[model samples]
Target: MASRRRLFILLAILALVVGIDTLERPLANPDEGRYSEISREMAASGDWITPRLNGLKYFEKPPLQYWATAVSFSLFGENEYTARFYTAFCGLLTLFATWFTMRRLTNNETALLATGVLLSSPYFMALGVIVTLDMGLTCWLTVALAGFLYAQSDGTSEPTRRRAMGVAWAGMALAVLSKGLIGIVFPAAAIFLHCLLHRDWTLLKRLAWGRGIAIFLAIAAPWFVMVSRANPEFAHFFFVHEHFERFLTTQHRRVEPAWYFVPILFFGVLPWMFTLPSVAAASWLAERERRSFPWRRFALLWAGFIFLFFSASGSKLPAYLLPVFPMLALVIGDWLARTEPRRIALYLLPVVVVIVIGLAIGWGAPERAKSAWTRDLYGTARPFIVAGGLVISLGIAGAAWLLRKGERVVPLAIVVLATLVFVDCVEDGYEMLSPRQSGRDAAAVTRQWVDPSTRIYSVNYYDQTFPFYLKREVTLVNYVDEFALGQASEPRRSLPTVAAFVEDWKRPGSAVAIMQPGLLEEVLKPAGLAMILIHADERRVVVRKP
Candidate 1:
């Protein structure tokens, strides 16, 4: 009864923390805006096979997130919340999957702790609500890893093993659909490493490879086949350009230092990060002593390999490290559940001191920042940061006190609540950075002056969020970044240079264009084109022909 009650509370907290204000926040630039707009187009066009951004073939990513968001739009009537619903749903699913997988490997307490670690981690919580394919990819990968873990259990029934294997294969297929080849590659590599480490030939026999391959092909193959058939260029663009070149070269312009993910992994698992080294060391020693493939060790390999895999790649994004979080949660959860109360108290004291100092630094940070915008943003965010720090420091203090008092589970519960508050503060404070980052308000103003029939052009700059809010496509004028492939397919739709845009503008009838502020004086004034400034913001400006 007590366990059930605790589970209910945890579920309630997860729902409240993850679901609140999901729709209230405006979609931020580049990622959230770009992805949501693709789904909006997909939902509107009713063409599920080929993903079109601004009505052009966008083969950069697979169609899984597009499909999910399109479905959400169909049912929920197309809003910010609906666009983001799928990602949040996947986040919740991952939390439950992590708990179940850990429970199978360890005890109920360990599972509960691990689930809390995942649910409350600021990075995980932030990604949970953000509209992105990474959350969906992470969820499917988690399911596959969990299912594989269950299928390999020695005492499970034959039917149960079969079902688990089926899940494992299906997850791989969906994961492929979600992102790309890395979905299958990550899990396959982990399993191979595990087998190689154990030198267990019999383990390969249990994978039921014949049925598993069929399942993977059935779900993941059809989309690739259909899309490739529909668009011949897709084969090379997706396989050669997106996957191979992206991993091997810095052509995409997302190059970073080799150790980029080192700090990301550290900060990504905040509040619990300091506990990892000791816990990881102890867990690894325990796994070695067992002399068998343990769940903890498999999770470690999963996290380690994926981290290293992306670290070696030329392209890098912070969210790409998501696959590592669940496994890290497992390691942290297992440690917290098994470690002594006094030791847990000791570990938290330093954490509290660090957080207190961080709070002081954050409160005073605005004054020291070099950029005026940064100073203003930080100044506005100071309250939330202080509040978040207090919540964490106070909660840690309470949890530490409880640990010294010999109450175990309650302390973990306290920290869970603290983490929720902490993450919430961070998210809430993020609004200060939104105005410069989001084009929603600009797009809204654009809608008032420009209509669907108006010729809208993005002049050498694209505000990815604008089209979704404006509910129409914007022509690319002398600009092609990631849209180069799409532009290649339809050269007639784009103006290749400012001179061409100027020529077209002179002959056009009632057209509006958006571009960077400096372009007006540098390009338009010199070209001698008469223009009316419709709207202007710090990042972009909208101009209309008189």
Candidate 2:
């Protein structure tokens, strides 16, 4: 009862930490603003089958997150909180799933520790609050992983095993819906590699393929069938362009070296970094004396294969490796449960060194700013950086002290609290950078001039946040980036040339165009386009037709 109470308290605290600021921060552009606007359009237009962004059909990925966020918008009304609610909700769900799965696989103590490890993971927790599909993907993948572990574990009845496998199938289906083929690919590859390594082909027979495939198809196939039927291009674009080309070629322009995720993994799993080597060693050694299933080896294979998979991919982003963290947390949590406090304390020393270095860098951040605008932004963020460093430093110190006193769980709790504080402070600091990173402020100012009939043209550049904040789409003028495919499909929606936009501007009753300051000075001004500068920022300029 006491253990359960402790778990409840921990969850409640983590929930508050993760969710308290969802509404307070502005949506950052390119990802948050992009996804939010997609959902908003879906909700307003009442078209859930075909996902569109800025009134253009966007078939780059699946629509599960858009559907979830659209539902959130319907329930809560369109706002920052609603926009991000799905991602944050998925993050919280992943936490609970980790706790539940680990408890079944190991014990209550390890379960609690695993949850803490996952929550305090900077990369994982940071992405949880941000509006992105990766967290949703991570959530469903975690569920699938947890279900697989539970299904394969010893002492499970036939019915329970079937149910667990069903959960796994459902999770993979949702994961596929959340992102793309990587959902099914990751799990299938991990399972195949695990079986090949151990020479255990019997586990494949026990996967309950008949019922599992039915559950998977029931969940994941409907959207594909419906969307492909509606738009014939979706199947080729999503499956081939998004999944295959995205992985095999650098068409997305997100190319990076193979060792990219190594540093991300090192820093991402902070406070637990020092323990990974030993934990991995222990998990590998434990595999030799395995029982019905070598779950430890399975987990290690899961993490290793994913890390290598993304590393080898043509396109790589930091958030792409999120699925690996839960398995890592499980192994680390199991190690933490068995390891002595003294050894854990030793592992924390390097974290203190890293924190101090971080503090020094934070203090000097504004000084290193390239421009006055950025300097002000860095200046605003510096205090929060210092506060976060101090909070984590104190937590680490207290945890070390508690370890010295032979207290185990309380130290982990202290670290979790400290890490949450640190993460919160960093989030607050990042929010301070929103003015430059987002179009929220610019949109707020631009909203007074915009109405249903006012033509808004985006010239030379696109601010992803404008459509969502202004509650209307902007016409693109002589610019096509990620919207290239959309532009090609709907050529009437975008102005193809500056001369065409100028002609439209001449005939326009009330119109405004947003572009970079350089575009305003170098292009529009030189072209003798008569415009009144309504608003200007370091990154953009909002000009109204005179």
Candidate 3:
């Protein structure tokens, strides 16, 4: 493919991704919901210095996501679309940057294949729509990878390679600021491993150590220094707890089996998952001389290192493996350039089962999770969801047939991938994120009774999603206030436990408490806590004491 045609194809892929990804409502999962809301609060408060979680100075991850969302809040005035703005943009850049890099590494054929695989990947498309740190870190980190490849590609001389390495190093630093040390950590390890495997120490020595270190410090230091200085407690918790503790401990207890990423890599890269084997094989086969084969070993190391690296850690989540996505694209791109026509059908045959499984799961997700209300949220377009499922299933099968026939399916493949990722994952899965709460619906129930200054509490039960929707600080009595205190740090910094809630219970008849049903019987009954009907769900019970 010529440069213009390749550029056109890239643009086509970008359009498809952005369009499909735009379908999701800002379904605030516990984390994204809470994070976006906190960022908004900080932006509102004009306190950009101390990073607040819930309302506390949460010294957890670095503050870039919050800062990025805050900036989005500035332009669009704080909604789901605005909160997700930066992530979506980063997601596009990550996709395209991989394309450009892969093209330079091998050829346009490989680049197109990788872009197709990326366009279809579920994790990348799903996380791309939400307000999260994964996309931002992935973009800059992928950009750095691309820069390194540009540095190593055959004709680049020593000085130019050095400059490219400097660019890569600086990219790593910005990525570090975006997420944390893992930004640079995984890449550094992968590059070292790549060198070891290939016995090429030339690239390692090319980095202008003094100048590169200075550039990195210059790009990433400002935020860390300023934010740490203001928060005071950021260094220990961010470095010690967020990085070291999160990787090693069961504190979050999110451990998954060794094969956790297997299905994710399998399904998360759907539609293209069918093509991945060919893509990867081609990538490996492309290997030649040490420096001549840019896509060969480096791509594998980047993908495997990050995937296995996180897998070896104690805590695990689907989004943690995002950094490896571009490398996966790189490998698949290389594979595609070398894939034979006869082999395409082999990849397509098994996907009939995969799409069937995806349909059942995607269809059941809404019914089981009871996110049916979102259909109304989307108005008349609600029925389109059912259509979307069928469209996706049929689309996958249809696309597979195209790939099997060795038809030039760059466009058809693009559409199917985007639909599977955005429609099935984000559009339908948004409901499972935050349970429907009376607190979220408080305006409807408490509209008449609620004064601007009315006292409110999410007693005995703390759903971080509630206060975010309610747009005010609601106290918690005798529950997990750590998460709540993490969000809202001021006014009610200290929360009482059950014993303390018992001691502090007053029949003053002026407060409302939301508790789980079982807890209500024990905590309120003895105190003769009067009740006003507010809201009740399987998990939470709301009682306004009179």
* Candidate topping TM-score: 2
- List residue ranges in candidate 1 displaced over 4 A: 1-4, 7-11, 14-18, 364-375
For model 1, residues 1-546, the per-residue Cα lDDT tens digits are: 377547647655665654676445788888988999999999999999999998788999999999989999889886788878889889888988898898888777788888877865778888887887899999999999888989987687878887898899888889999999988999989888888887766777777688889999999999999999999999999999999999999998889998999877876776676787887788777777654457777888899999999999999988999978988998988988888888878877787887787677667788998768778877887888788889988988898899998877778777777877787787777776777778887887777777656888889899988888888888898888988999899888788998888888887578888999899979797878899887776678888888
Error of 2 at 508 (Å): 3.3
The TM-score that candidate 3 achieves is 0.86
Tens-digit lDDT string for candidate 2 (229-299): 99887888888888888889998899999999998997888888888889999988877967667777888
Error of 3 at 308 (Å): 1.0
> Residue 445 of model 3: what lDDT?
54
Each candidate structure's TM-score, on Cα atoms with residue i matched to residue i, is 0.96, 0.98, 0.86
Give me the overall lDDT of model 3.
0.67
lDDT of each: 0.84, 0.87, 0.67
Rate residue 502 of model 3 by lDDT.
48
Predicted structure 3: clash tally? 13
Off by over 4 Å in 3: 1-26, 157-163, 274-282, 291-293, 358-389, 410-439, 442-452, 480-492, 499-512, 541-546
The sequence of per-residue lDDT tens digits that candidate 3 reaches over residues 1-546 is 575466556655655565455634544546666777778877877887777655566666666777888888887786667777778888888878888887776677667767766766666777777667888899989888887888878888878878887888888987887889987887788778877877878757766778778888898888889877876666877888888988888787798888888888877766556666656665665665443745567777788888888888888988888887778877765565566644655665576576666656655444444445643343333345556555666665666566666755453454445465445544553444334522355433544455665666666666655555556656666555335435343536535666555444453435555667777776567766556767665556666645
RMSD of each: 1.9, 1.3, 4.2
